[model samples]
Target: MDSPSLDPAWTQRQRPPRLERRLGFADYPQVQNFLERLERLCERRQRYPDLGFGRTYVNLTIYPDQDATNVGDAEEDFARDIDGLLN
Candidate 1:
């Protein structure tokens, strides 16, 4: 059977979203340990957390699990050291 038609707008693929947040760390050991833990978890979890590392900073992005509205929950749950990073 022929499929029902979707709205023209719906048929178009969305642009790759430019969604992200930058969090900095001054204490290298703490941040490295935190990212390592997160990397381990991502190996077992499906949320697919990504960290974009800089000389002294990191950018966070998660896919297929959250959007802008509830991104904080992921940060809180994944990045426990987030509080330290913020200070």
Candidate 2:
């Protein structure tokens, strides 16, 4: 395997596979559905944190130091699974 270059900001950037332009829906139903999904994900994260792997991880930059890191990690895994399903 080729070794990566020496870079200071390599881990901080999230580059997309490709970039594209598109219109976003601002309609009521779309907005409502989005809010509902966000709420549901939050609830799931709070209620059940061990839905994915037994191990959990958390990023310390955003959230306050707490015991819910496992839950957040599970939520991310859950979201990624849904994205995979859709694609």
Candidate 3:
């Protein structure tokens, strides 16, 4: 079997894949729906974190979709999951 380092794509600084999706967050309900879908996808794909004792964790990072002018409040809202609507 070929080792990872032996592969052609392997290098000193191999870039990891960036899984990005441009989701819309115009309102609370929409944000909640997005979170629900994200959670379901994690569960379906079994993308849970291992804690070395059989316990699993689901980590999420919510961010704003607005530009520089609308960043502050919208960013806060996104970080807080649309005022806890996503919780």
Candidate 4:
């Protein structure tokens, strides 16, 4: 499948075919808030991304669903929604 267009903030990958982004915050509380919001988003959309976070940053990786070989519409939309959390 052809890859979908994604936000510039998200890095598109081949091979495994995934999307990734890193978000930064000033403190742990801010990171916590972002995580909470992301959780809500995931619950609402029924889509979740791989997440890694420390005191002030989150590394998010989104892979195509199922056995797909490329990023597609759902992944693109999810990436966009995640970016919206920053606004």
- In angstroms, the error of model 2 at 19 is 16
The order by descending lDDT is 4, 1, 3, 2
* TM-score between model 2 and native: 0.31
Off by over 4 Å in 4: 1-5
| Candidate 1 per-residue lDDT over residues 1-87, each given as its tens digit | 743332221111224432345656676775686677656666665455566875566676543343454433443444433333344
Itemize residue pairs with steric clashes in candidate 1: none
- lDDT at residue 45 of model 4 (Cα atoms): 95
Best model per lDDT: 4
| Model 3 steric clash pairs | none
Candidate 1: C-alpha lDDT: 0.49
Q: For each candidate, what TM-score against the reference?
A: 0.46, 0.31, 0.33, 0.90
Best by TM-score: 4
Candidate 2 lDDT: 0.32
Q: Which ranges in model 1 have alpha carbons more than 4 Å from their true place?
A: 1-14, 65-87
Cα misplacement distance, residue 81 of candidate 3 (Å): 22
Model 4: lDDT equals: 0.92
Residue 22 miss distance in model 1 (angstroms): 1.4
What stretches of model 3 exceed 4 Å from their correct place? 1-14, 48-87
- Candidate with more favorable, higher TM-score: 1 or 4: 4
lDDT (tens digit, per residue) of candidate 4 on 1-87? 765557688999998899999999999999999999999999999989999999999999999987898998889989988988999
> Could you tell me the TM-score of candidate 3?
0.33
* Residue-level lDDT tens digits of model 3 in 8-87: 21111212221112334556665556566655654754442111111222233323232333223433333333223334
lDDT, model 1, position 64: 32
